[model samples]
Structures are given as C-alpha cells and as structure tokens.
Target: MSTILVTGGTGTLGRLVTERLRAGGHEVRVLSRHAQPYAVDLRAGGPGLDAAVAGVDTIVHCASAPRGDEQAAAHLVAAARKAGVPHLLYISIVGVDAVPLGYYRSKLAVEKLVGESGLGWTIVRATQFHDLVVRLLDGLSKVPVLLLPAGVSDQPVEVSEVADRLVELAVGAPAGRVEDMGGPEVRTFPSLARAYLRATGKRRPLVGVRLAGKAYRGMRAGGHLTPEHAVGKGTFEEYLARRF
Candidate 1:
C-alpha cells in the first residue's frame, strides 16, 4: 500500500477519492485549509504541505479554480514538484481544448503545467458530473419556467465513477494525458431538466433558449461531450433516480 495525498479532500470529488483510497488499504492524507484529519493549503503555501506529502508516493490533485484563476494551476504544479512527490494525478474536465469556456481554459492551463512539470503524472479529463446537472435543475426550478441554453449537449458522468478512475490512475504508472471519460449517452440541457423534473415528480416547464456567441456555438457543436472514449457506466436516468 502507498501513501496518497489528496489536495481537495473536502470537495464532492475529493471526498470520494479519499474514501476509496482508504478503503483500498492505502495510507490517505488530505490537504485542505481548515484543520481536519490532514491539513494543507496549496494557495497559501502552508508548512504542513511538505510534511503531509513527505513520504507520499502519489498526489491526487483535485483542487481547482472557477475557470478564471489560471495561476493557481501553476502554483499547484510547482508545489507538487517541490514536495518531491513521485506521481501527480490531475482531474480535469472534457472539451477544455474545444470549448473556450473560462473554467475550461484554466483547466487546460493546469493540464499544460502538469505535462511540462516532468513529474510522473496522469491527466484524466472527464465530462460534467451528475451532481452538476442536479444542482442546475434544482437552481432553475425556482423560476416559473426553467430557462436552458438550447443546442448545448453534455454527457454527464457520475462523481463516484470519476473518483474511482482517479484512484486507478493514482495506483498506476503515469500516462501524460489519458482518454476522456463520459456518460453512456449524450444529452441536451432542456431534455435532461425535463427528465429530472418528471423523475422527481416536480411540475416545472422547461423553456429552451438558444444562446448566441462562441460559447453557445461551441456547446451546440457537442464540444463538451466525448465522442471517442467514454468509460463511465451510469446513465442520466440512473443518476436522476438516485438523486431525486
């Protein structure tokens, strides 16, 4: 068993990764700002970071900024290098290269950092999580008619599946950039929202609005969904059943 350090242990994805690593009989350490079982902060360069990663053989870097903060990725890569961590696994989003979304741009920058860092690394790009879809549906339900960006498609993967994949990457040898992982099927926002509403027994009408711009055009072209390699098993309907 190897000692693995997870950068975003408190988050939705990080929490699951940490649990999986622990369950696999690996020594797990978490990096976070707040004090917990293990505490370290990449942004502030906390002292605990070095100690937390001292003997760690692998680092699962799940911490990321909201698209606009590209500098954070550079810092994280540098920190991992300085810590002398042998392996670094970064979890990234799909369509980062095809779409010009701010968040995707940041993720792309991070992927570049990991590639150039010369550290043993595996960069796994995945589709939007099922939780993101659930959150969007819940937030849009407050409006009388749910307004969704038309023509945009997404293949949402389960967070648990992504977490499992991250663990697999952590334990394996670094493959600079791995294949994209996506859901079983590609789906549109309005259709997904309606399906989720019907599954949850909520009566909300969905209004599809075609957005005009580069972002909308990119999404309409199915830039976000992976076409070639999709390894996840859960479908949108299964995710809805479990969530609602």
Candidate 2:
C-alpha cells in the first residue's frame, strides 16, 4: 500500500478523499495547519513539510485558502519535487479559467504551478458542491428575502462523489485536466433558492438582482457548468431533503 498524504484532509472534500483512500487500504496522512494529530502545517512550508512529504508516494492536494492557494500550490510543487513524490492530484473548480473571480484566478495560477511542477499530476475540476449552495442559501435565508445574482447557473455535485473521482485519479496514472465532473442537473439561483425555501420552510421571498460585471456576466453565461458531463447522481432537491 502506498503512503498517501492529503493536504486538506480535514476539509469537506479532503475528509471524504482521505476516507476513500483509507478504505482502499492506503495509509493516509493529512496536512493541516492546526495539527489535529493526523496533520501538520504544510502551508507554512519548512522542515515540517519536508518531513511530511518525505517517503509519501502520492500527494492529493485539496487544501486551498482563497487568498493563499497559489502560494500553497507553489509550496507543494517545490516540496513534491524535492521529495521526488510520484503523483500529485488537485481538486479544482469548473470554469476556473473562464470565470474572472479573484479566487478562480488564483486557482488557475495553482493549476499552472502543478502542471509545471515536474511531478506526475492530475487535476479534477468539479462543479460547485451542494453544501456550498445550501450554506449560501442558509445565510441569505436569515434576511427577509433571499438575494441572488442574475444569470447565474449552478450544478451542485455531492462532495463524496467528487471524492470518489479524486480517489480514482489517485490510484490511476496522471491524466492532466481530465473530463470535468458536474451535477446531475443545472438550475438557476432563484430556482435553487425556491427549492431551499420549500425544503427548510423558510417562507422568504426570492429576489434575483442583476449585477454589472464581467464575472457576473460570465456566471450568467454558465461558465461554471458543464452540462455535457453531468455525471453526479444526487440532485439539489435530494441534497436539501437529506441535509435540511
């Protein structure tokens, strides 16, 4: 069994990936900032990281801070190269290059870093997770009306399903920028907001306000969705029912 190190093992997708890898009989180590026994702060980049990356066969990098993702990826790439790690896998978001959001731009930078890092690597770009949609709705529900951006379409996939794909990539050879994974269906923000309202019995009014920006227009153009590869099984409604 290979010793696999997970960068964001405590996060939503990271935890799921760690579990799947462990179930498949691989020894997993988590790279964490808080040091929860299973992880160390690989984000800081020092002897701790050198120690952690040493002898690890594969590195599944899922830990990403919106502002620090690029730096973190650079750190990982350097460490992976120094350690002579075999494979490095990254979980990215769909439309990262198309979307003009700052975070998305950072993600694109990291993509470049990993690609040129001189290690065998694979990148799995997945659609937004159901949990993110729900979390956004939950915050908006606190207000009298749920406010949403106009022309934005979301395809929310189950995190565990994405974890499955990442694990599959982990076990297989690197396949740089493979087919994107998306939710079973795509829906507008107002549509999903209404579904959440009904599910949670939050009788809030749904409002779709138009915004002026290239990013907003890009989202409205469905830059974040890949309908052709809607391979996720769980629907937003199903997730709402189960979660709320």
Candidate number with greatest lDDT: 2
Give one digit per residue, the lDDT tens place, for model 1 in 70-177.
Answer: 565566666678878789899998889988977787788888888889789899899999889888888988888888887777889889999999998999988888
| Candidate 1: residue 25 lDDT (0-100) | 97
Query: lDDT value for candidate 1?
Result: 0.82
Q: Between which residue pairs do clashes occur in model 1? A: 67-103
Give the Å shift of residue 146 in candidate 2.
Answer: 1.4
lDDT of each: 0.82, 0.88
For residue 9, model 2's alpha carbon misses the true position, in angstroms, by: 0.2
Residues 1-244, candidate 2, lDDT per residue (tens digit)?
8899999888999999999999999999888886555455555677778778899888999998867888778878898899999999998999998889999999888999989888999988999999999999889889887889877889999988999999989988888889999999999898999899899887987788999988888898899899999999989998888987
Worst 10 residues of 1 by lDDT: 65-74
